[model samples]
Target: MTGENVNDTTGDMLRVEDLSVEFRTANGVTRVVDSIDFAVPRGGALGIVGESGSGKSMTSLAIMGLLPKGGTATGSIRFDGKDLLSERESAMRRIRGDRIAMIFQDPLSSLNPYYTVGVQIAEAYRSHRSGVSARAAKKVAVEAMDRVHIHDAARRADHYPHQFSGGMRQRIMIAMALSMEPDLIIADEPTTALDVTVQAQILALLAEIRRDTGAGLILITHDLAVVSEVADRIVVMRGGHLVEKGSVEDVFSDPQHEYTRRLLDAVPRIDDEIGELRTTAIPVVAEEEKR
Candidate 1:
């Protein structure tokens, strides 16, 4: 389970080097992701920011071994010193939800409406952990839900996805990811389509979770505002190329690339401080209310 460090003595949770993704069609080959390099330090947060079709999601999908048909990835994707690109599908399956978890953009589509939220969460947990009783898995599911601040989680577990608000359903997605206690979490536009207040709540919850669990985070989003709140490092992508990479502070203070500067300008509140959006607090529930 141990992995060698990437270009440094300090070990990294995940390291991507010269990764390129391409799709072959009747017309020709299209390279959506050029050779790009980045790393997530253990327990650190890395943000991949870009506009739509900038290959942010494709890079994550490549890391997860979930690339869509007709797409192929080349170069190294190292997770904890292991070369994920070389790993077999079976090995990747074992590592996917168990060691590395992903939070998708749309929780509704990721969840099943026919199943109770608890059932879905428990099933996911059981799939990764063999020989666990359903009752044990269900308990884990409830705990996970509670960990994500889903109020009345034990009762709410029985509710279907539709019964929950958009923010709450996103929390459910996070709960499912937390249930596994993975080493790294890749969240792709997790706050998309959420209201401003709800987005802040979700971001706070994610920051709290990372602090509590010491899990490395990969947050992919187009919003510079969102990443400024949570990420320690920033990677800017455009047309599959890595235009900029640096500490969040440096990137925000003095962007080197024209594209990066444009992205910052596109922020709705460009006048406001960049990293100040993290002040939102996660709501706390009393223990007595759990019953």
Candidate 2:
């Protein structure tokens, strides 16, 4: 999958145009992310929100050039003034962890159980930086762990992924991403596996990392509240289509689509009437999108 060159910097860190992802199966080609377009300016945050099977993760994977087998992505993904989709696999390999980093939802699954946390982080750092010795890389790994507020990072770095709690493992993943000091960070449902308190902590930590490093952030999730908490702008997707997008205040206060309204209405509120009836009906707009 490749795209034509479009040299439009204009202060944007990442620019995507008519991006689409499809998977070819035994039956036929199924589009998972359809003609979506958005931008993340340098040091800015963009949130992609939607329900399950909405192609939020697929969009991120397409940008990373990590699509699964039989999956193909078309259209333009411009990153830092270069067309990512046009780059060769080797070029993408250099850019992936060095210029762009990703934080997946499940750290346990993402991290290798056979390796120590320190070694994994060190290898990730050393992979992009040539001529870095193992000792130096280990030091960098410990420092990265410390940066994420991992307690006793130097000691914990020697432990395997299973030795850490779910939240701790997630922090380790964040530390690994930060070790590269990438210009862009794409977090896909980063808080999905944690408790509410830990989720808030992780979000705050991510916000702090962005603020401190001035890296562009793309957060993908289904929770509108989570996006509202951290994202400066939001794009709402449904059934692989981009339904609406705007500033946090704009979209939340004045949703222009029925699907967006239904999503907002479905959120449980603390001050609701006792035993108040809640509607479980899917909106007509959403139903049409499914079809």
Candidate 3:
């Protein structure tokens, strides 16, 4: 879909208002994502969190114009200035992978196993801009991989997705997302499959990319800790509806909703109660003093 001009909306980089999605069941109409209102400013990061079926993924899909067939989406997804629902698929395709892009959770599914990593990245680049030669596109791909700290990017460029480790494959996904240099990047649980350490690395890399490029980010996930580090704002959803929305500190420290409060409490903290638990163990190790 043709992107609406940003000049039309005040302070709205991406505004999703009253977006309702429904699925037709033999039983009746089942609404998956209720009418929800949220916005992301230029260079802003909005984190969405909830349990499964909370409609977080569906919301992102609606925004990306990638919702599945047979699902009816209603409401306004204003990117910059245009209403996305009004645009046709071909129009949206032009914007997708160019002005706007997504990084999915599963790198293996997102990438082509048969093609070289470089080939896929280059293809993505070439699709948007005409006259960008294969060599030039590959150069962009390599540069993007290098930017994400992929070592020997030129050498790894020809490797298939299966050849890379899980973390490396994730880095490749980020590189592809970065290649287009889109105005917005919808990353749906980008670190879910990675180990804790690698998760941090990917999050750090995304934060760095966001800082350096000034691109607005929509991070969709269920982990509060992940969003706590990278998201400026957080929106909590429950049972297909929004329960809470606020800055990271506001939602985590002083949550208004009971669901949000419980989510915050569930997160394991390094200090406070955890520290007390450790202290209890520490006194046992000094039994010699008591003797």
Return the top candidate by lDDT: 1
lDDT of predicted model 3: 0.83
TM-score of each: 0.89, 0.89, 0.89
The segments of candidate 3 whose C-alpha lies over 4 angstroms from its true place after superposition are 1-10, 269-291
Candidate 2: worst-modelled 10 consecutive residues by lDDT: 1-10
Q: Could you give candidate 2's per-residue lDDT for residues 1-291 as a string of tens digits?
A: 011211123489899999988887666678888899999888788999887778899899999999999989999999987898889999999988898999998998889999999999999999889999999999999999999999999999999999998989999999999999888899999987787778889999998888878777899987777888789889999888999998889999999998888778765641252212135333223112222
Q: Between candidates 1 and 2, which one is better according to lDDT?
A: 1
Q: Estimate the Cα RMSD of every predicted model relative to the unseen true structure.
A: 10.7, 5.9, 11.1
At residue 128, candidate 2 shows an lDDT of: 88
Candidate 3 least-lDDT 10 residues: 282-291
Clashing residue pairs in all predictions, respectively, total 0, 0, 4
Give per-residue CA lDDT, model 1, range 1-291, as digits (tens): 222221132787788999999887666777889889998888889999987777899999999999999989999999988999999999999999998999988999999999999999999999999999999999999999999999999999999999999999999999999999998899999987687789899999998888888888899997888999999899998778888999999999999998788777767653353422223211321112111
Per-candidate Cα lDDT values, in order, are: 0.87, 0.85, 0.83
